[model samples]
Target: MMNLKYQMIIQWSEDKSFLVGFPEFPGQTWRTHGDNYQEAVNNGIEALESLVIAYQTTGETLTKPTFNQAA
Candidate 1:
């Protein structure tokens, strides 16, 4: 099993496009127009999976990535 840590933020666009990204994983982003929130999240997950696989293949190690949520 691979250990991956990331946070996602979903935003709506006027043109009916969904934008998603992880604050921790800069440049890791995905967008899907004409999709719902779930669709955007799914796309984000796929992007994360690809990123993790690529990093693991290159023997890069992730050290203690944390996510902070505020109430």
Candidate 2:
């Protein structure tokens, strides 16, 4: 796999007793979680890697991450 990077956001869920991670990429949504912060991060990475592979297999172009440029 290419050295691609995607943005990951993690937050604590008071109702779930675990951290939730969301990767900002095309066709990706809430699909990973962890009992703790580290677990969430690890899960997020794995999820992103898997997503990239799936997209490649389907003959879809990889999603390019959006960036905020200062004016």
Candidate 3:
């Protein structure tokens, strides 16, 4: 796999659902049905990969999210 240096924030919601999002990739978020944190991270990665491919096909540039903004 290619090494893509993208950062994302993963947290558990109040309802126990995993909330994942890449602040750099605005509007990109995904949720998975599992208690495992790793599962959530994997789902988030898949979501990001899809978004990146879509953006590339359309000639759109991806905006990198900063740590401050993600926080």
Looking at model 3, the pairs that clash are 24-65
The residue-by-residue lDDT of candidate 2 on 43-69, one tens digit each, is 877877887788889998876776666
- The 0-to-1 C-alpha lDDT of every candidate, in the order given, reads 0.67, 0.70, 0.70
lDDT of 1 at 20: 79
User: Distance (Å) between predicted and true CA of 21, model 1?
Assistant: 0.6
Model 2: lDDT equals 0.70
lDDT digits (tens) for residues 1-71 of candidate 1: 33457666788987787887766655555433227888887777777677777777999884346757798
lDDT of 3 by residue, 1-71 (tens): 43456776788888887788776765655433336688877777786677778888999987764534554
C-alpha TM-scores of all predictions: 0.67, 0.72, 0.72
Cα displacement (angstroms), candidate 2, residue 45, comes to 0.4
Clashing pairs in 1: none
Cand. 3 TM to true fold? 0.72
Model 1 score (lDDT): 0.67
